[model samples]
Target: MKRAITELFNRLRFKHKLFLSYLIVIIIPIIVLGVYAYKQSEQMLKIQGIGGIEKNVDTISGGINGSIERYNHSVQTIVYNKTFQKIVTNDYRDLVNLSYDLKEYLSPYFTMMTNLDKEIDEIKFYTQTYVPEYGESVQLASRVSEEQWYKEALKGTGSQWFSDNGIIVVSKFPQFSNDKDTNIVYMRINEASLFNNVAALAKDDTVIITDKQGRIIYSNQQASAAADKPVLNTAQLSALKEGVIDFGGAKSYLVKKPVALTDWTIYCIVPAAQLTQNAGSIINATLIIIALCILIVLIIIWIFSKTMLRRVLSLNSLMKRVEIGDLSMRVRSESKDEIGELTNRFGSMLIRLNEVIDELFRNKIVQKEAEFKALQWQMNPHFLYNTLSFINWKALRSDAHDISHVVTTLSKFYRTGLNRGDNIIPVQDELEHVRCYIEIIQTMRENSFDVVYDIDEAVFGYKTINFILQPLAENAIIHGINRKESGRGVLRITAELSGGKVVFTVEDNGNGMPPEAAKTLLESQSSGYGLKNVKERLQLKFGSDYSIVVESEVDQGTRMKIAIPA
Candidate 1:
């Protein structure tokens, strides 16, 4: 058996074996892929088919609904107008008599509705007679004398309605009783006019009109000679349910939405075959190409098997260049289409990826500057503590006990103000710091200034950025209070919390600055100098939402409001 097999193989020509091998490699996968694509294309077709129908339905429905509302407004105007009612009750006038001149009086209004509302086929007018004998000159449709709409109008009910058989209509009931007996009149709107407003989408192949029932009253068909197809059946209609289902032999898709002005359902249908028909053409072309590709693949496999070591070496060199941030690297190719676009996009992505890596490395330096900035804060407070501690200890050794008490209180102030390296301090600690500062100020000059703190204890524990309150306190002292009457410069500080923010106001009973000066001080472009510096730093640390606002009147003292996030 082995001898026979070897002889059979030797008898086959090299070119024949090559072609057969290539066909096995290329043609088999093509057939497999084609089958898969065919299934997917069918599913997509159903969805697109259903979508086209649904979009047309929505367009028509919205347009029709809008036209009904507009027509109702026009008819309502005619319903109450005395002259229009006269045209109905007395005698129907010629088109020209209903106007101001010898020309048609209601020329614009009636013509726009009747002649322009092309979707509507007719607009009916009715008087007191239900027998339909009185209005024969108007050329009435085979008398709707006993129709429900006529009966309803006689009973004084105005009909703004959507009717069966795909009709949308609105009417006005005028019960006019002047000198004699009472008589009712109805101004009927042409159903087609409302439909005409939406005529653009009405003629599409997938048009549908659903009544109050969840069923189709009208569907699309053309003026072909063939007899009309029966619309839909029970088994096919079952696919219109809310979940996915196998449609007819060719898959179908469905969607449901409520019909306008009524409790009706609109079901959209899509056929799967329409979506994926192109895939069949693709499959045939792919089969022919695969037959050619099979010969090429066999030749390549044999050549590569002989020179595997050399090709492997070239691949190693290329990979090494790619590893060390060489993003422009790409394997050369001659073919065109999707594969080429994909390789081009991948090369572009690598270039962008390299740029992002470089950017991240540079941001680390900005992060370092922020760290150095935080360190600067530590040194200033540490200097204040050392100086205050020496003064307090030296005063204790001497007999000046009041001085010692002052220094001790000042030391305690810094301790609470700093609070073991915490960046945020409570409002209570801030208030105590202000009280101690006031004491130190008093020691300098007796009764030279008066300070008051009107702080709410309930709000003391609310959090604020450290030192935020003290700077504003100092601003009022330097710029507001110190410029007052010689004997007593009054400074008042109040702190409260409302709506999840610490709200502080510092006001002084001193001679306020002129409007221009104060405004310039607040409005200057350069910030972070004295009061400006504190405001800028506060904003940078906490953002614009948590910052200070200033308000003042020239003689009425100055008030500053601090809004800091809690």
Candidate 2:
């Protein structure tokens, strides 16, 4: 069977093979997935609807319990009040004194407690003693002693919640009172305040809250008709399990949660068919999507096969042309596949071969021109040196000693600065270069500043870049000593070796600058051939680790230091 299949596949063209392979690999899986999704979507939607209803029931139960707790707290506050208990339990002789205590104290306290929570409609106290009613807030206990809700509150140790006449009542007996003298404090809350918090989450669902005895405390839909009635008859309530149920001949989903600290259960009911209403449309859309994907895959397979064949044929023709010595033609491909890579490699080989042949002839022409330029550059510097020498000789013959001295000093400065076009020189030669610059400056300024060299012998043999110290010396004389008002200024130069590094320091006691001026001296562009040029040259030769730092204070001397690896 395998041999037969292989023989059948080998008989097909390349495009036919690709189309058939894609049909089996891609289209078949999409169809299977679409069928599975169609079958599972109904059950999944039903499960999600039940889960959402369960959360809504829990939130509604929590909101109801919160309202009950708030009313209970207000009752407890009045029950434990010493002043209230004393007033309610006292045996009064005059009715006017009783009315004064009730009107002056108890009325304001009840009003204050009721004002604290917006949910509380009224707060009232029921006393067994005959304390005639002072407003509706103080009532006779005998009036409600025989009532069912009051009897139920007496049976419990703490507060009890009751739904009576569209209002919620929280009743608690006084802590200090005996059974014979029952003082009950009860707070009434409007039922709408408890239901409004969870109503938004229940949207289209019906919620029923029942007490421990299966009596419905509140029903969001049927409350006006069935308040304080049984949630359902015994036979029907037993059949109302969670998940799908047949309620009044319609399929529905039911979720139930118990309220904490209260024996109340909350029920949320939603229709089952309402939850899965869109399942049919989703199944039809899946089938359409599977068909569209198969059509697109087949179309893409055909175009891709045709494009591959055309590019392969073009590459073969180009290779044949290149075999006969034509290197100007180049191949172009936008794809990142194997065929594109092969075409690009072949084009690169032809380009590299042409470049090598052209570079061989160009190198010979450049070498000859460089030699001619070298001969031309050597004459200019020698001509300048000979002219300086002639000026020195004329100065001495004409008896101008100062002119001869200045011309000779200028000659030494240029010669050491040049250094035969070599950047790296001995430390001694760099010192000599700076010394010549200082002498020229002193001659121009008539020896106004004294020079002091604090040299360490160890740094003399080390190598450094030439013409570095000349700018520092020139700045010390021009900006420093020349600007001194009264006394002669002093310039100090120091060289030392420490921790595998060579350090040079230039200090001047002339009219000193502020610290800011000294620090930014190397960064200013106005100083031509100054400290900034020296810093760049040192960094280029010795890497960035070498640099110059400056330190100065107002009315004090300025000191510039250079450090480099030895």
Candidate 3:
């Protein structure tokens, strides 16, 4: 089985391998931990549900017991009151006088006791004597044995408790009256005020109070007429003594405690489903979070694998191109890791190979050009200079000074341009050469422009490539000065030694080119050869350290700066 699994893994692609790695390293462990956490959480919820139900039931039971004890105390107080007993057993010949006496004596005691406790609603004295009602608070009854509560009172000795529909505490006074009639003192408790606290405890549950005969007299849901039915039958009530019961088609937790004063039982019934609602919600939320986490992790894994493999495939494609003799192919990477280093090395190898091929090709053309230039230079200059000098002399003898000056300047321009077949010459000679070229331009243009020279004496001895400044001056005059709408221009040439370098500038106050046009002067195919030739020769001789920079703006004129190492 292990061999089969290994074979399957080996047959998969790199992305599949990465997915398997994540499943083992991240997903499986999370799933295991999530299952364990779910089980532990379920167990914890069960224990907590049981504990919480038990606590609430104990609290409600204690509150109910305390209320019964307070009512029992009230009953005992009324039963032993001598004033009340005397008022009940008094023999009055004048009925009006007796009624007045009853009110004066019993009214004060009932008012004082009932005022101290708001739970007692009515205090009544039931007897066979002719007693009129004093007020609604204290009642005098003529029939003692007719009422059900009175009959129940006679069955027990002291403080008999009964609730037919509402709570009543009845106590009989036998010693006070020797007649066949029995006098009873009973106080009816205010049902709402007596059980308000116990009812509050059953917010989402059910609380029921039943009499000794298992008849439910009070309930938390008493306001709802539909809930008036008995919740537990006698069999279920008997079974509830063990702690829990299944009744009314729902599993419920039952806590039953007997009220010592009334022998009634208070039952707190909580549904099993209600107890676990919060736990179920929590488990569902945890499941959603776990699923989202797994999805996010899978997305991250896919993106990472795709990015890494794409780079590797790009390098492989470039290698294939190189293998097919496309040596110009290169990998472009900015990373500093091992893959980036490999890409860089591969790119460097291609660059070197291309450079070797380019050098060999350039050498052959250079050799042929050098031989042709040497042959052309041997014949052209001497004949050209002699012809120009003859013209100058002939013009001078004829008293044509302008013609003589133009031919003389033209001769000097060509002589200096040759520079005795040398590539590098003194800075003074190059300046003199540019001056001659500018003079010829002035003569041809009817001297419409002015030329200024600002040369530092210290840089006069510095050597530079011949014809460098002459092309720049010619470019300024032809492209810049000649195109001006004003037709009047100024040309300035300056040279200075700055920071161990020879800085030369050729500037013109004329119509200037746009910025894009100025940038393309060095790179444009349509740009003339003169400026490009000078730039190339400078780079070839002095390496890339020396360069010419052109700055121009429309209507702002143009300036060209040439920098060479001193």
lDDT of 2 by residue, 415-436 (tens): 7777776667899888888888
Residue 406 in candidate 3 has what lDDT?
A: 88
Predicted candidate 2: what Cα RMSD to the true structure? 24.3
Minimum summed lDDT over a 10-residue window in model 1 is located at 130-139
**Model 3 off-target regions past 4 Å?**
1-48, 91-100, 129-144, 174-181, 221-241, 276-566
lDDT of 3 at 549: 93
Q: Give me candidate 2's TM-score against the actual structure.
A: 0.39
Q: Model 1, range 342-372, lDDT digits (tens) per residue?
A: 4456556666877797688557545634543
Which 10 consecutive residues of model 3 have the lowest summed lDDT? Answer: 222-231
lDDT for every model? 0.58, 0.74, 0.75
Q: Model 1, stretches more than 4 Å misplaced?
A: 1-387, 520-529
| Model 3: number of backbone collisions | 0
lDDT of 2 at 4: 79
Measured with C-alpha atoms, the lDDT of residue 381 in candidate 1 is 79
lDDT of 1 at 466: 61
Scored by lDDT, model 1 comes in at 0.58
TM-score of each candidate? 0.35, 0.39, 0.37
